[model samples]
Target chain A: MSTATETPAQHGLAAHSHGAGTKSVKGALDRFASFDVADHSVPHGREEEWRFVPMSRLRGLHDDAALDGSDYTVAVDVDPRVTATSVGADDSRKGSSTYVPVDRPSARAWAAAEKTFTVDIPRDEIIERPSVIRLTGTSADRGAAGHLVITAGRHSKSVVVIEYDGSSSFVENVEVVAEDGAELTVVAVQDWADDAVHLAHHHVHVGRDATVKHAVITFGGDLVRNGTTLNYAGPGGDATLLGLYYADAGQFIENRLVVDHNTPNAKSDVEYKGALQGKSAHAVWVGDVLIRKEATGINTYELNRNLVLTDGARADSVPNLEIETGEIEGAGHASATGRFDDEQLFYLRARGIPEDLARKLVVRGFFASLINRIGVPEIKDRLMTTVERELAVAEELAAEAAGDA
Target chain B: MSTLEIRDLHVSVETENGPVQILHGVNLTVNSGQTHAIMGPNGSGKSTLAYALAGHPKYTVTSGSLTLDGEDLLEMTPDERARAGMFLAMQYPVEVPGVSVSNFLRSAKTAIDGEAPKLRTWVKDVKTAMDNLRIDPEFSERDLNTGFSGGEKKRHEILQLELLNPTFAVLDETDSGLDIDALRIVSDGVNRFSSGGDKGVLLITHYTRILRYIKPDFVHVFVGGKVAEEGGPELAEKLEEHGYADYVGEGAAV
Candidate 1:
């Protein structure tokens, strides 16, 4: 993996060249320069983690700038107790905020156009209730991009839901931080309107003894790429990543997750499940866990399971574990992808369930185990509704195929 | 007349031994509001009969004619058969993980009845049915058969039978895994459905304990995919008392 550090001049970007309104851009550039971006783009296929991912997807995105703002209206059906506060550029510094600029010029320009949003759970405040933060883009003429930063303070616990719903094809980056002794549950639902292209990056940092549970549900967009990276920075910290995704009829959804155990006694559990249907619908899940040598007492496990709903659709799953030390209590990973089980289908059908309903039943059941793990009734209910809606769409597509046949 | 007529029913399944015939030349008639018990040893094709009647794709009826109330039953799909007033309370009910029993039952009722039942009436009906079976109303919210005890699964099957109100029900060994109390509750559910005066039941079982609660009007000993003996409910008692030793010889003959 190339870890080369590139100066702004090498990338053909002059400092403060974009004009007066670009002060945030300059600050972003200064902050991002401290991190290694060139090495992050290493297309190393020798490692098992990047074996199945089509690195070619990153081809045209290398020099893309931040997308411009679109006339999109975000639709939100959230709990009444939860407020959707929009954090404009002026309000960014009021709370604990971390910012990372995109290396690509296009993503940088897009982020510069749309104001950033921040969701904050006050310090030491425990809101046993759940809340949602929805972002919708409606730009039809051009691509869009923005940044979301969330913070959970010390001794505080709460659930935050972030949904991206819109008509624009764009890129998104979300960075989150959980301070010491804080607990945060974040659910991201990406159900963009058709004709949208999206690439999203989620970076999470868990402080010492803190806990973060994150889940992603993807069911829309033309070409969607979701990348999540979590670093357990504090001792005794834990992170759990659970995701459910479904694609059908010409939709493509790809997810890549990397969990880094940087501190000792840090634990991580990752489970992602998905289903694909219709002709040429593709669903992919790539999970990688790296247990650093110094993280001796770290315990981690990951599992990715995919179900193919049709003969023409395909699912790809890759789960990798790199353990530097074996002193951990337990560590393992499993990945499997296959078509529907005939035995299970027959089992339901034999009970007087129609083939269509039986298929829906089985697919719902496949995700039931994960839904139970969500631990939030509001989010769980919404997940069920979204899953059922997707199934309904799949059935319609299947009916059309049958009609064509 | 409410009658389940199976004429020259032949069924086969694809197995390691190639296409194996499980049901051969089976013939039977079950009348309305009457209980009929089918007793057979393991691998005697009792469950195959249930699957065939329920239109399971694996149980291909190569040569058979099944009619319910004079309508061609075998010609319909499983869901269509269910809508046509046939219910199969499976011996091993499938564990549907996410679908609650209440939701599944409501959907099944809508499918069978061709319309959604009224909310007020539906709730009242379900509550009354659950009360009669001595089942907690909270069971309705639980996922269908998912993590349910064996006895709970049996009771759930009966709950479906009562709520769906099918004209003819094929209970495929509903008593196989039930204990004494569970057997009584399950039998009580079946009795409530049968007492409706418009329903007919075909109870398949290996034990006669359930029959003690929901008495059968007729008993047919199924062996080698054929009814080897037919008698009154006394045959069930006889099998329970003396075992199937005397009938196995006759069952082996064509």
Candidate 2:
């Protein structure tokens, strides 16, 4: 249960996506070189990069449609030490220092965002509490666009949380930069109202000897497709990307990550776990890691595990590792998707636990390891309560199915 | 006094060929304050009897009657059976990862007893029990049986027997993978469970070494899915010396 912030030195650095036993498409990152909307066209289902996504569900996010209406809003809560400023096109944090859009949706969203919300940690400043940014979208039947840029000054440390709620079609780009020797923890909590659709491009760059912890937690949404890319600016940098998601009926949650090991002696560990229940609940996790020939002594391992809790729920996990020079440290990836373990159920039931309770215990235990690793106590408590609520709904569905039989 | 009565129990399991019979007309009775050891050779359906009694779904009791204190045990689920004072120490214990031993034991205790254990005394009880079984205190923090050695798993079984304290327990080869020290420790735990003169034990094994520590009042030689010979402690010594070669052939009285 040791968290990324606690042992930041190990399980650190680089970004990636991997397929367990199949060849992974490496062109996704290559296509990410341009921020101009004209450079990246709308994706059709035929392309390898856009096949799994339901293009119609994007709600015109990919067609360069004008972001209409003003139903969604952002609320910032932070200490005075950290400043949240509204910057323009000439802002210092803009330009190539940030990530280029890999798809039409991101490019259009970036172009449409009139104001870029920027949060900066003062040089060598340490903030004790995490800053919270709440994005609440009204069910106004309109699409909205936004952009956020977060940067940590030299030798500074802080946690920034971006939470999404309510219902609307939303597309945004978030860029994070950790300066040399700085530590940053960015938590993206997408607990949206059920009808919400969010497409986000999250890019993070870690500096020399710096550590960055990124957490992606998604529970509610019609569709949430997150592509989070990581790259190290200097050697000895560390990046730990953690993700947890739960998808229910008619919900789709996808996490695509690319951790680039371009700097020597940098390390990274990627762990993403998800659960799916109810009819048509789908979860997809794609982990790809690319290590350059000069990136020697890189210790990186990516893993994705999914638990399918009921009938008609699907979990797809792919972990791919591409290493140019195998001479440095160990590099590997693994992914697994399975239903509840029968042997574990039997063991619990044989010891006097009822079937429903046993199933809940098994699932809770399956995710408990990662849940316990979260650094924030309030978030941890809230997640557990949410998990219990989901289990209760699962129990009702199971009872109904049994009754129909 | 409580009593577990099994009569003419016939059991079968589903396979590729469909429903292969495993138990054929086996009869046994265990009363309070009694220790009965059922010894058998390999493929003699010994484990099947234990699993059948525990109400495993795979092993269907095709024809039989089982009762506990005049109550129909066959109608109850496995958890209900456990709550009704029946315990089975499995031959191969299943591992539960990410679930700490402390939480697991307390969960079972709470479920069976229908109440949460008192935190202070329950912790003490678990610590003392683990100490008596020679288990490290850190074991309580580890996942249940995951990566545990054979001896540790066996001792953990006995540990449950001691803590759960069921009126009747069927120990299936609890001595198979133990060193001398672990064997004595586990047997001692079992002896402590039945020492009150109010519990019953149905110890199943192929070897006689465990009998030295937990003496059985009755010994039954099982073959071809049923008991072929029944006697006292001396029968165990006889079988240990003569072996079960004579019990496997046809025309051997059931």
Candidate 3:
């Protein structure tokens, strides 16, 4: 029941001030003055989705030094059929493409300074090779923020891969638009170093008859939060969101996804799988689907599954479906968080397979079906690399567990 | 000589109804270079015998001694049993989705031998084994038993047997769900693995179809979780002709 026009102070900004700022920050503050970032605040452990996540790890004060020029770099690999362009927040000709600054006197101060980068795909273009954006951040003292915007023209087909790696803690925001008759695939891989803390927010808009597939792989980071929101604006549009995460000892990864089926004949499917090992390793998967009153004949399904590898490790999974209209075609959601299946493990071990290798095999098998659904080869390769690395880490942790036992 | 001996093996499983005995007073022995076939009706503890021998956790031995080549088998863990030269071709092989068959076989080989296999020899040996089993070389790259058809899973099990080269193997009803062609191929792989002098096999099955390919030196009929009858390969033909009606009657009395 909350409107977008509500003021930040009204939504829990009493702790901070909307003081005077630079012209650019002032404009954003004025435009979104009624928007309350606290509306999005989910108190740690109080919300079911954040139960197993170590939010305390990210609640401490972060260094605010600006990143040095050499500390961050952006590289892109695009298909021959598609052209890539980097547009800053000031680009005006691209209507409705203005970047929203995260830092300001607003309630969303924790996410401040996160900027958006934009990419445009022309009409009728079929991008065969996946476009890869590699962001390498090497700052040791200061945090960084980056933004991305992707637009697929009508009847166009394209793939985009965004890789995030840096030394410092930071936040990122990505926005994607798929016009009518367009098909887009966006794959994000976060392979930051062990010391880095990353928070990413992704917003996607799907037009009529458009198709969008978004996949994320998280294997590295001390603490990471990747949030995705998909809004189907036009009827007959389809959206799919898939994610895989592996976190070992001392690593915390949280994923939150919302699919808003606002129009009729729209379909959305989401599947996220994760594995956690080590003493304090933790993971969370939150899947929310909203079927509005006008969205009749909607088909929405979501599934979240997590595997806990050790005794102290934890996983939280929440799949919620809100159906405003009972006229939908089909809607369902499922959530499961469980320790490794001992019966399955024994079944494998009985085959003469070692216990360690057997557990790894089962975990890999659990994610293979979803990984195969990723049509892009580059993204698939990247996912495999992340999976292998996580498996290696799991093995090391298992060895340590054995040593302790 | 390599041999697997089970001395008065009694196995039970923990269930909601409390502990229920599955195998009661079972004893058998299979010497090196010999094939032994065990046949029984469903619920007669055929699978339990196999699982107990493989050291499955669910089957706890109340009283038993399993030894492989004079080494205490029950004293070691399942992995240790495999490393100690005991292999189990599972009745229902678990599907491993992400690990490739090649990777799984290599890891098993390394674990068994306590060292990594020489890459060149390992690859050659794997390729030869795959060729012998009529399996496509590309299958090695596929996930272990993931998405495999019933026949393909059985063939993959045989491939493991061929690659691991354990001294003693327990083939647990591998021909259950296979078509005739797949059954023949799987039987061929088992026969190939048993061709060497140091290999021993305890083949457990409900049907006598597999025995037509790999003849058994001895056939034992299991009833009431105990060996009710023991004879040469002729006993298999006798059971195939006449079902386990008489055995069931005798088991009821006992």
Candidate 2, residue B2: the lDDT equals 89
Per-residue lDDT of A210 in model 1: 94
Ranking by lDDT: 2, 3, 1
**Superposing every Cα of model 2 onto the true structure, what RMSD results?**
5.9
* Candidate 1 lDDT, A1-405, residue by residue in tens: 011112232211222222431343333223232133442344344544345444454333434433555656554443444344556754553223233433342234324534666666777888876776767776645656666677787878888888777766666667778989999998888888876677787878888999999988887877777878887657999899999888877787888887777788888999898988888888888876766667777767788888876669888876655545445655667777886666667655544567777777778878877888777887677778888887777778778878999
Worst 10-residue lDDT window, candidate 1 chain A = A1-10
Rank by DockQ (best first) = 2, 3, 1
- Model 1 C-alpha lDDT per residue in residues B153-209, reported as the tens digit of each score: 788788888888888989999998788888888888888888887788999998878
Q: What's the distance in Å from true for residue B129, model 2?
A: 3.1
Flag the better candidate by lDDT, 1 or 2.
Answer: 2
First chain TM-score in every candidate? Answer: 0.78, 0.90, 0.80
lDDT string, candidate 3, A1-405, tens digits? 122123332221111112221222333223332234444434445544445656566533222334222368789777766666665545542324223323221123224433446677889998787888888878635555665778899999988888888675666667788989999999888888888877776778898999999988888889888778777767999999989888888888988876767789998989898888888888888776676668888777788888887778888776665545556666666677887777667756654567877777678777775787766765666577677777777778778878998
Computed on alpha carbons, the lDDT of every model, listed in order, comes to 0.74, 0.84, 0.76
- Distance (Å) between predicted and true CA of A226, model 1? 2.4
Report the lDDT tens digits of candidate 2 across residue range A345-405: 8778888888877777788887776666557665777877887787777778888889999
- For all the candidates, what are their Cα RMSDs to the real structure? 11.0, 5.9, 9.7
lDDT of 3 at B229: 98
Top-scoring candidate (DockQ): 2
